[model samples]
Target: MEQEEALDWTIRTRDPDFRDWDAFTRWLEAAPGHAAAYDALMLADADLPALVPAEPLFAGTPANDRGAPASRWRWRWIGGGAIAAALVAALSIGMTNRADIYTVDTRPGEVRVIALDDGTRIEINGGSRLRLDHNDPRFAALDSGEASFTVTHDASDPFRVTVGDTVFEDAGTIFNIVRAGDATRIGVAEGEVIYNPDSDAISLPAGRALREDGRGLTIVSVAPESVASWRQGRLAYDNAPLADVTGDIARSLGIRIVGAPPLRFTGTILLDRDPQRFFARAAPLLGVTARHTRDGWILKERDGPQS
Candidate 1:
């Protein structure tokens, strides 16, 4: 069968009415190729079929149509059978290497500080994902989210943060990189970092920034202390929009803020202080009043206050 036909069949097999456990088991037993096809469809990594063409799978089905209920006997039989089959496969395949993998995730309203084996300190912001290979020495990948790193001085192996084609590397420096969709905003706080893009490379010193785009790199200057302020529980901004400042605030405090724009706030507030107090200081700067609403805090223009 063609790939399209196999996909169609797989879709139909997952239908609510296709709950005949015996029939499905018999079909799997009748042909090894069928089982392989199912696995291929389910296990195709990276190149898996896109869901755009899967609309027909639910053509006539309602949204509320739940899958078939479980059967105790069927569940027990399938569970035991799977265990036996897995044991056989494991014995045949022997041991497979799964590389040293480490995941550090932060839940909403939570802050996490971790120390790696290399003596590097990492403070992960809320709603972030940090994937590290505890063994790979030459380099490591920062898959997504924002993280402040105090890299240990290591002339032997330089730390690298891979954000798309651009790679930020430094042997002994502190920096923060926030991955926002296609673009990555990097702020160098201490020492120097090499921002490399393909064949080109640019050295970024402390209090400097380099924004990477599809075309090339754009260099700019930033205050080093402001970028590293997260370590001290503070959101420092200078000529930054309300949107950008709010994002940093939400990440640092693990709280959500929703309100209108034109909130031009530019100042530094100690994040360790009470969140409400921080908002009070920020609101006056932005010409807005901070109020507690159903969803965290909302900053709006004051009703009436003489300048």
Candidate 2:
């Protein structure tokens, strides 16, 4: 029974995405013999001499294959117990990813795309934080920032994204989500999404958008084609609050923008990595003069602001 359990753990940890570190640590620490047993199986897989097993449990047979070098295997066999303990300590130290959680983050200017095991793809914008489970593909949590999800629909197992206390579940959807400060914005480019399906349910269909903040929930209209447009370096807006527009440019372009949206905007702003180049074009469309300051860019009302 002990050998079988140890064999199971050895095989599981070998998986590239295996991240249930805490449980594995507990199992090893629960019994004194667990670490020795687990390491023995690991050694056998590498065709090295096992510390506890009388013979290599599953060593391969190859005529020309001399086993892994003796110096390396000898060190591992002698130090397996200590090494196992050290691994537990190391995996337990990090607070970012606890238990089965695996975090994916991007730098301010970085964009990343994560492909999950079950054919779901998530494209996270710059300055985004997303979390996924090592075992569950349908679950995701957004700690902060923006992400675009293109989920493969499974009626039996709907894909769910949790933002703060709110939950959004996909129903054959392609959606974009942004969480900034105390505000969350959701837009569905295709299909539908259920907001808290179990209670106070709200359905967001294609071309629909929702924003929630300390104020309350507000539903709005969005252009279906313009959703997740940041992926294509274009931001499309129709009667969008200037605050939302400015927030997006700052987030996607990776710059600090300080301003209050006293007015509404309706236009498209092309993305440019260079701040100077970007504002030169965006300011005209936004009807604001972009001034570079020591801290960041400040958007002041342009003389004769565009109507």
Candidate 3:
């Protein structure tokens, strides 16, 4: 019954003519978690606009038809089966949105460039997933992997990217965000950005980057030119551990790295879009040698002097 009421409020609040704020506020405050539940339902509905073809949904409907009933538009666009299928997809991915959301997913070793409706652009790295709200052009959600965003600023509707509970709010910026496991790294290339990890918010300007994880936030200096190096088939690592570099290489090449011998590596590794070339250049720097096997590349400590 509570869930039903919350869903009702979710639909009702979106109605332009529904102005009963006092009663709605009273109902929301009357129970704990009601507002949260309502918010979740609204978020779920936001993705419904994207599940169906826009032509069939809006063909007969006249533009700027404010006089038409809200239920008419709701039934026209949403069907029970469509909603069920969309819900399943959303639940499986842990991301939900209205019908007007655009999503891009890339396979391992595949990179994609996305031009959004609002003139904002995104470069999605290998094995990454990105979602944008079409209705609210300023909002986006990065579900996993890495992506670099070049936002077309609108101060009235500030651009925001949500990664887990953390939010990166742009102040007219170009930034790269990488999500590996539970850790997230944000690098600002141009202008500045406001990062909110849970309740704490921090401002990061150009040439600065930060990583957040279970331990805490660790800020670092990153060259602005290296912000989206992956787009050019290069990776710039500044004092990064061997394991992290290996993981990136594996993802970028669509190959697994086995028996990785650890060593401190700090330099810009040019991938050249060739897995073998990358391994040849990277192995010597880490005091290791790469042996290509049937399964994948195996890194072993150099048999003689460091290559």
Candidate 4:
């Protein structure tokens, strides 16, 4: 039970948006060997060093980015059988090294550009997981996170990106994709993306965006330049869900934004790189009041002034 809980905490704390440090510290203090067990498990894995992408670009770093006192190795556990979800909490030993594949995992609030052998440039957002093949060069998979791709298209082979079951085939253009939780979003700015060309293919051209969630796929019109605007220190939205907006804020700012209003937002917000400065202007626009907490900021619906 202790090891299971330790493993669970290990995975949770590594999450880009993880908070609850006090609670985690309490758990660490609960038993003397608890921290030891956690440390031992993490040290054993020693997550491979992330290779620096050529021609990297820097972005703002989030403040108060605290977590467990451990190394920066991420682990992904995959157990065979029906109850694989449960195994995630019980074990943290599924990281694999393949000769053909490599992964680039970004830190929260970090933005950088990486190049492929084919000269395709990808600007990856913070807290993202992207896998690339050193051998194939054309096969890329975004396990989770967000990235903008400027593909070096090939008519014969084409560049492919796998997200969940869907594959985005580049059709000679620039586009951005994001997979947050179960929801996936893609937008085209200068080129086109074939949403699964094999069967039920959807042509996604410039000035358009698509979002897939539990309710299904929703296609909407977006300003072409606004696509992946985060690359330029801004976030643009059009009737976007409150949860998604806040989630994006948390990811971009690298702090745990703890609540979402039951509302959708339509506007653009500048990423000022400073939490307080950003909220001072953004809270009014979002119609929320940001209250500071030990864990992070809590966004509450504006309900008049306090007594």
lDDT of each: 0.62, 0.78, 0.73, 0.75
lDDT of 2 by residue, 193-287 (tens): 99989896899999999999999999999999899999999999888889988888888988999885487788788999999999998887888
Q: What is the lDDT of candidate 4?
A: 0.75
Q: Residues 1-307, candidate 3, lDDT per residue (tens digit)?
A: 5655564565556565766655666677577556545545556665745653444354565766645344543464355446445545553343333355556566677777766678889888888878875467788899888899999988877889999889999988999998878888889999988988346778899999988889998998989998877777778888876776787777677677886665667788777567687777777877788988998888987878763
Model 3 collision count: 10
Q: Is candidate 1 or candidate 4 better by TM-score?
A: 4
Per-residue lDDT of 116 in model 2: 80
Summarize candidate 4's per-residue lDDT along 37-94 as a digit string, tens digits. Answer: 5654454344321211111122232344343433211222222122224443223443
Full-model lDDT, candidate 3: 0.73
Q: Considering only N, C-alpha and C atoms within 3 Å, which residue pairs clash in candidate 3? A: 46-97, 46-98, 46-99, 47-97, 47-98, 47-99, 48-98, 48-99, 49-99, 50-99
Candidate order, lDDT descending: 2, 4, 3, 1
| Cα error, candidate 1, residue 246 (Å) | 0.5
| Whole-structure CA lDDT of model 1 | 0.62
Number of the top lDDT candidate = 2
Clashing residue pairs found in predicted model 1: none
| lDDT for 83 (candidate 2) | 43
Off by over 4 Å in 3: 1-99, 303-307
Query: After aligning candidate 4 to the native by TM-score, how far in Å is the CA of 135 from where it should be?
Result: 0.7
The C-alpha RMSD of each candidate to the native structure, in angstroms, is 11.6, 12.6, 14.8, 13.6
Candidate 4: residue pairs that collide:
173-191
- Pitting candidate 1 against candidate 2, the one with the higher TM-score is 2
Better of 2 and 3 by TM-score: 2
